[model samples]
Target: MASSDTYAAHAFHHSFDKERASGAITLTDVHVQFHNDQGQVRFPVSGTQFSLGGASDRLLFIRHPSEPDWNIYTSDLSILKHPALQNDVQIQRRVQQIKNKRRFTWGVFASVVMVLVAIPLLVVLFMDSLTGPLARHVPPEWEQKLGETAFAQYQMGQDFLKQEESDQLLDPLLQPLLQQLQDERYPFQFYISSDDAVNAFALPGGIVVINSGLILKADSADELLGVVAHEISHVTEQHSVRNIMGTAGVYLTINAMLGDMSGLLAMVANAAPYLINQSYSRGFETQADEKGLALLYRAQIEPEGLVTFFEKLREQEQKQLDKVAGEDNRESIESTLQFLSTHPATEDRIDHLQEQINELPHQNTLDLSLPFTTLQERVKRFVAKEDEEPET
Candidate 1:
């Protein structure tokens, strides 16, 4: 047993005013001495008993019950283990209770913090997997509404060719393909854009648009039909709508997790316009290609038309690359082909289409008798007329 006189502790002393006063407390069998700047004051153990109040592992707290403002705190263990205090049951029990409560409180606090951090982390990690199911829950009518809004916004400043003669010539070529792919749920609306780029895109619901450049570039009516068939499949498969929802879902999930409703609302407001210009993922593009080929097979149109069109695009891409190989305008030339940038690699698509065609039973070549040359001439004339129009 260590002597009480040998057990002294450095501590902070507080009086009724709650001001911290540095002091050393020394313990003896009959009294406790507090030595500070003012003087050495003695507290008789018999007259002044101490109670432990919310102590920690590295610290001990003591105060007189009768004099509530008299408090002492120390991080020294030896003072509590002195011969004069070791046998006190009250002090031992109070210290044990404080330690237990401290551990329990820290455990609860740690658990709560972990749960708060983990919930958002888990959401972000699994967000990609959740996109499909969440997208499916969006109503078809909602998709149509989005599509209508996007189509209206997309055509705001674009030149939409509306000549009756051109429509008459183009409608017959598209009617058969539409008849093959149309369903009661989605009534397709087709549009022709006078933009001089080999591009076509589908909006959510059933809005499909084709560029005049693509039509003029086609070698045959079958190639144009194949392009139309591919875009049709995008609508039929709801790829456009699903792709939009997938993008918006990720955006919304992250913003919601961060507790930013303003950002989320802003995203929702711009969603339709953003989706109008967004490109589909490679997987969605592949699905469209496979389904488009199937649609052609079902319509008795040669699948080779799709393959041939892809081959032509690839050849054109190569020619463009060669032309810009050593030129300073290579970047500009590459950026001009927006269709190639958006679609999957042409070479891969061509190979896949050819593979599908090879699996089918051999058949005679399609009769390429459609007035493709006449349509090209008409497209050229319309483009020339548009170019002649003064810029507003």
Candidate 2:
């Protein structure tokens, strides 16, 4: 214990300035004083700030009265055992208050960490099961609106067949497929993108876009309808909407679980531009493929058409990649033939679809006898018109 009334300490020049000097400190019931070679300073105890970090550090931390920025940190053994500080009522209460505050802060921080960890863990474990059920709860109108927003964003850099022409090209094929769908919820709308990429995708609201390249690649209306059926299954099976749900961040997922549709919309709107390109997980793709074949069977269309189209896509990709086998500009091939039409490059996917088809009893299927040449001609004419310069 410090025997003398004064104990040595270090004091900052001003405002916790690094220019510090040695001093002797004395404590009183109502005041504290400091003496150094240069001068002496004193301040009332009630207004001064004191902190005993813990029993282990055995240090005294103080803030000067009326000069909060001026602080003191001292580990002098005598200071730790001082009678006036160890016994003062106000000083001890303030120290206890600080200790309590630190405990509370630590408790709050640990709670935040636990919540952060628990949410994602729960999502990973249950998200696959949750999305399908949650999708059913999303109102149809909300889905349509989200799909509209996302479809609108997708149109910025793309050109598509005219509505009249798209109807002529797709209506005959799509009407039959739509008629076969039972208990359908979405008001499915179809568009034909004039681009040459062999891709087709569906959006949250029954919005489906088929690239002109896919139509040109198909040998019959069955093949075209097969692809359309698969895309429609994505909507009917709620995979398209589920893909949107999957893109939402953790907080957004919480908002969704809490039934905050508006917040979910905001997340979708922000994520819309790329939503069209978001690939379905293999699980989602398998579900769509299986459901799509069911739709084909109900429509009396050849379920073989879906399998055969998958085969065509495979042949096309292998031929393209083989041509560019040693070339670094393989990106050039991908830019035009992006077979995002199916996931996994439709790679090894053919075997799965073919196996399913093999297990099914063959049905007497309708021959679409669609006008393949006329459809291609119309697409070429429309694309040429779109490329023409306006007359000056």
Candidate 3:
């Protein structure tokens, strides 16, 4: 026990004795002195520490250092001889409760952090396998619904030829070419158009249209076969249908992202002119060239005729350029010759075909005789009669 006092400074010392019992603790004669600017005051703080025996025991004790000593037990307020000291213990307990609440808040914050980092990582790990199912999830009717819509849009821009042009100049050449290429394995149709753009194309539903200018431009039968076989490969592999489907999907997805509900409707309404630039992909072009050359070789036609056709077109381009300097007319003509587009240039393709031909054994010769000169004479006579006959 210790005690001290200072009158001028208004201070006093406190002292007490502590003892431990079976499940509680006792404090004897505790003296508490309060000092402020006004004055000093001394009091007796009385309490005996009592604990509820458990895994964790908390005990606090205080007592009065006076002759009339009092003992207080923390278990009950009535057991405390000094009620004022119990109030001090209650105030300390509230401060401790605030600290426990802050700790629980920190625990919740940590759990949220872990979830935020883990969820994306799990998704990335499984994404590859998930995409396959996602791609296949499109409805079964989507292709037909999309196909009809695309075809309608594509037909609006077509230019049909006059009936006289069809019977005379066009049908005479195409009918035989059609019969020559036909196989029981694949049935195809030939549509003649008067488009003079020097272009030819194939469509999804086995429709192959060739322009008269393209036929007149080809000097040899083998070169014409090369072009036909190329279009035939497009039909067999279904590249046109695949392209239409792919383009339509991309169009729809973009419009959907923009929140447009009528994208498909708009696409269907304008499909015909839309297909004008449906260029074959580069891989499809190469595949077609390889297959076309094979078909020519199988038909006993020399691949050199295809090469010769390209040479003639190149020569025509030079003459046209010399006549019209800085003009793009020749360039446009060259574009229709299969040399200036996604397909490999005719020269490069010829080199590859020549290499393949070298590896295969030569077949016994072929005779490809076309009667274009004789057919032209007959067509002139027929047209003259139509012109001489006046309109009814």
Candidate 4:
């Protein structure tokens, strides 16, 4: 506690040269004199200080009227002895610099830690995006039900094909291939449609539909096998399931990053139709192609057949283009061109298959007992006879 008589004294020095320009000056001791409120005697003040700016030529002094001879504190007098507080200023500056440096270092360290943590988390999210669709979140039965609806479309397609009598002709060629690929754990059903469009598609529940045009256009059994292999890979991998999960995961992650994940479930729900119909991405196609080729190769089927098929399809596309007359027809024809529209264009796919062939060390030729041409003709006659027989 400070006493009532205690007072703080202060002193300051200013350059005399500036004052000399204005008028005459005198050299004198400089100090402040303090007195209590009662204006009585002075008392000891412990923390007295002085400050100065610029050059000082004169000294100033002050003392209380009552204690005219009172001695100044040694510490206080020592502070005013020098021209400036050089060493003390340096120490204060160094302390401030050290504090700023520590703050900067901590800031950088915190940034580094955030980066290290965030990078791996981002990577995990990205990798998880690739696998998210496979979680089987959609009921398996619903997927099967969707597949059944597509089968009804198949029946409509078959009815349209009855006019051509080409529908029955494709089964013999397809049956053997299906048998070759049949896995007891994951049974697949094959449907041949009368559609002249060169397309083959797979639905969620292990159902694959091939257009008669695909059969008619395929140059060899091997080429057809390539198509078969591709579709079968989609089924065996349950890529549909995987795709659903992957897309959903990505959607959720994006929403989360944006800080609005509450609507992700609804977004996914709305996207269901598009997802169900969605084809695989290019990378997914490559994966399925490569894996399917391995399966075919292991089954002692010549993978080169896949490449050969692509060549034939490309030629057929050109022929189709030549026949179409108008721009609209050209556009329509262009759309039907397998390489342009289908998963793995016949040409690009053929090239990839060739690469796979070159890479595989085991190049064994497949000996298919049934020549596709003869079998195709036989199946055609059988379908015709069966069609001519009656409708029950």
Which one wins on lDDT?
Answer: 2
Worst 10 residues of 1 by lDDT: 8-17
The C-alpha lDDT values of all candidates are 0.68, 0.73, 0.49, 0.53
Cα lDDT, model 3, residue 369: 42
Preferred candidate (lDDT higher): 2 or 3: 2
- TM-score of every candidate relative to the true structure: 0.58, 0.60, 0.45, 0.53
In angstroms, the error of model 3 at 332 is 19
Give every collision pair in model 1. none
TM-score of predicted model 2? Answer: 0.60
State model 3's lDDT: 0.49
Give the clashing residue pairs of candidate 2, or none.
none
Measured with C-alpha atoms, the lDDT of residue 384 in candidate 1 is 79
How does candidate 1 fare on TM-score?
Answer: 0.58
**Backbone clash total, candidate 1:** 0
Whole-model lDDT for model 1 versus the true structure? 0.68
Local lDDT at 236 for model 3: 55
